[model samples]
Target: MTDRIRRLGMTAARFALSGALLWLLLSQTDASALMARAAAIDPRWLAAAFALTVVQVVLISWRWAVIMAGLDASIGTMRALRINLAAFFLGQALPTSIAGDAWRVLKIRSLGFGIGTGVRGVLIDRTTAMIGLVLVVLVTAPLLLARMPDPAMRWSVAAGLGLGAALLALALSADRLSGRWASGRLSGVAEFGRAVRGLLSRPVTAIPIVGVSVMVHLLAGATMWLIAGSLGLPVGLVDCLVLMPPIVLVAGMPLSIAGWGLREGAVVAVFALVGVPMDGALLMSVLLGLLLLLVSLPGGLVLAFPEPGPGQAAPRRIR
Candidate 1:
C-alpha cells in the first residue's frame, strides 16, 4: 500500500512538472508560428524519420540479444526484438522510463532464466547504452563546448563524462570486488559486476556490442535530423549529433512521461545555442516523440497476442 501511494505521488509530481514546463515554453513562443511550421512539414521527410526510428529500435533490440548471448541466455534476436518492442510500449505508457527495463527483466525470467541472469542482462544492456551516449558526447566535446558557451552546460557535460569514466573504472575492477560479495546477500550485484568485467576482458565480443550501441544513438540523431528536414529547419545533422546525446541522457531520467516537456525544453535550449528558432526545435522534438510513440504501437499488438509458451499450443482463429 505504501509503495503504491508513493508511486502515485511520484506520478502526480511528474505530471505537474511536465505540464508546468510545457505551459511555460508554450506561453513564451508564438503558438501560431509553431502550428504553421508543424502543418507545413514535408510528409516524405516525416516518413523517412519514422522509418529511421524503427531502425533504431531494431538495432537496440539486436544489441540486447548480443548482451544476452554473452551471458549465455541465448534468447535469439527475434524474440528479443519482440520483447524490446513490448517493453518500449510499456516504457512509454508508464511514468518512468526504467519501467520498461523492469518489464524486460520480468519477460526474461518468464522465459525460464533465473532472476539473476535477467537482471544482469538488462543492466549490462543499459550500461552499454549509457557508455555509448557518453562516448558520443565526449567525441563531440570540442564542438559542444564551442557551441554552448554556458558554464552550466559545460559542467553538466563534464559531470556526465566523469560518471561514465567512474563506471568504466569500477567495471574494470569488479573482479576484485565481486569476490568480497560472492557470499553475501548482495551476491547478485557481485555477479553482475563480474559479468561486466568478463565482457570487458573479451574485446572481440565487446567491440561489436558497444559499436552497435553507438549506432543506436547515431540513428536517433539521424531521426532528429530528418525531423528537422521535414519541418524545413536550418539545423544540420552534425548539430543534431552534438545536441542529441546529452538531451537524450536527460530525457531518460524518468522525470516525466516519455520525456514530454523535458525533452522539448532541452531541444529548445540546446538548439537555440545553434541559432535554430525555439519554435522549430520544440516542433521537431514533439514530432520525434510522437513518431516514437507511433512506432512502438506494434508492441501493443504483441501484448494482446503474445507468443505461445513452450509446450503450449498457439492460439487459433475460428473460420
Candidate 2:
C-alpha cells in the first residue's frame, strides 16, 4: 500500500508537471495556427526521428557503462547496455525520479557485489558522467557564445560556463575531503569517506569517463537534430549541440516532475534563439518526449525483474 501510494504520488507529480508545461506552451500558442505550421513537416521525418532516438539510447548505454567501469564495477558492455536501456525505459514509464534510479541501483545490486559498493559506484559514475557534461558546456560555450545572436542565450552561456567551473572544483575537491575525513579503519561513515577519497584520488580515472560523457551528449544532440530534421525544421547540429547541454542541466533539476515544464520551456527558448520557430520547437519537444516514453517501455520488463533481497536492499549488477 505504501509503495502504491508512493508510485501514485510520483505519477501525479509527473502528470502535473507535464500538464503545466503543455499549458504554458499552449497559453502563448494558437492551436490552429501551430497545427497549420506543423503541417509543413514530412511524415517520413518522424520515422527518421525515431531512428535517431534509438541511436541515442545506444550511446547512453555506452556512456553509463563507461562511467560504471570507472568505479571498478566491471559489467560487460552488453550487460551494461541492457542495464542502461532498462533504466531508461523504467525512467520514462514510471515516475522519473523513482523508476530510472531504482532500475540502475537494483541492476547494480544484481551483480553479486556489495550493495554499499554498488550504490557508491553508481553515485560516483553519475558524478563523473555529469562532470563530463559540464566540461562540454564549458569547452563549447565560448565557441558558440559569439554566434548565439540573442543576448539572453549569451548570458545563459556565461552562466553555464560559470556553473561548470564550480562543479569541476567540487569534483576535484571531493577526493581531498574524503581522504582527510575517511582515513580511518572505520566501516560506517569513515568507510564511505575512504571510498569516496579513493575514487577521487585518481583524478586521471575520471577524465576518460568525463570525455566519454561529453561524447554521449554530442550523440544525444545529434539525435535531437535528427528529430528536428524529421519534423522538417531547419535546425543545425551545432545549434542542437550548443542548446542541448544547458537544457539538460535544467531537466536534471527536481523542481518539476521529471523536468517536463522546464525541459519544454528551456528547449523552446533555446530553439527560438537559434531561429527555429516557437511552435516548431514546441512541437518537437512534445514529439521527443513521446519518443523517449515509447523507447522506455521495455524498462517495464526490467523493472519486473528486480533482484530479490532484503526489504528494500536491491541486488548488484556486476560480479
Candidate 3:
C-alpha cells in the first residue's frame, strides 16, 4: 500500500481505538468522579509533573545532541528539540514502525543532514533509546517481583528482560559489524568509515550521551507515574518507574497500528495485577498519550515547510 493509504488507514484505526477508549472511560469509569479527583489533585504534584515533563523533553533532545556532537555536528538545540518532538509524535501516532521511523529520517533530512548521515545517526539515537528502556526495566523489575510477584508473571518478566538485554547487546555489536561492512564492501564505505569514525572516536561525548539517555528514560517513567496520579490511582513513585516502560515496550511492537487499544489494554493489565481497575488504568493511558500528542503536534507545523540544518545531507528514502 502507498504511504498515503497507510496513513489514512492508521488515522481511521486510531480514531476507532480512541473512540473505544473514550467509551470505556465514560461508560465504565465515573468521569465526574475522575475529573473531580483530577481537579482536586495536589497542585504541587501537578506543577512538578509539568516541570518534569518539560525537563524530560529537553533532556531527551540533549541526549540526541550528545550523539550528534560526537559526530562533530551541531544542530540548533531548538531544532533538535522540535525534531525530537516530531519523532515522538510519529512514534505514537503511526501504526507501523516503518512510517514512523521514516518520518524521523525525513525530519532530520529536512534539517539538512544528508540522508545517509541522518539515518546512521538516527539509528544510533534509537539504539541508545532502546538501551535506556532496558535500564528502566532492569531497575524496576526487582521491585515489582519483591512486592507483587506471581510465579508465572515473574517468569515472564524475567524472560522479557533477558530479551531486552540481548537486544541491546545486539545493537552495540551491530554497530561494529556495520562499521566494518561499511568499510569493506560498500561503494560508499569511505563515508561510512568517516561517520563511524567520527561517532566512535570521541569517548568524551559517549559517556554523557549514554548517561543522559538513561536519565531520559527514567524521566519517562516519572511521566507515567504522574499521569497515573492524574487518574487518582496513587501507585508508588518507584512502582510507576518500574511498571510502565515494559508495557510501553510491548505497545511499541510493530504488530499494532498506532498502538491503538493495545497500549491501554496492556497498561490496564499490568496495573490490574496490583488491583488498579482496568478502566481507570486505561483512562490514565489515554490522558498521558493525549498530553504527549498535544506537546508533539508542534512538529506538524515544523514539518509543514521544514528548513535544512547544518548536518551532512538528507538520507534517501528506502522505498
Give the number of the best model, judged by TM-score: 1
Candidate scoring better on lDDT of 1 and 2: 1
The reply for model 3, stretches above 4 Å from the true place, is 1-44, 90-100, 110-112, 175-202, 304-319
The residue-by-residue lDDT of candidate 2 on 214-244, one tens digit each, is 7778876877887788777888888888778
TM-score of 2: 0.78
If ranked by lDDT, best first, what sequence of candidates would result? 1, 2, 3
List candidate 1 stretches off by more than 4 Å: 175-187
**Which tens-of-lDDT digit does each residue in 215-248 have in candidate 1?**
9888888889999999998888998888888789
**Which ten contiguous residues of candidate 1 have the minimum total lDDT?**
172-181
* TM-score quality measure for candidate 3: 0.75
Which 10 consecutive residues of model 3 have the lowest summed lDDT? 185-194
Q: What is the lDDT of residue 31 in candidate 3?
A: 68
Query: How does candidate 1 fare on TM-score?
Result: 0.93
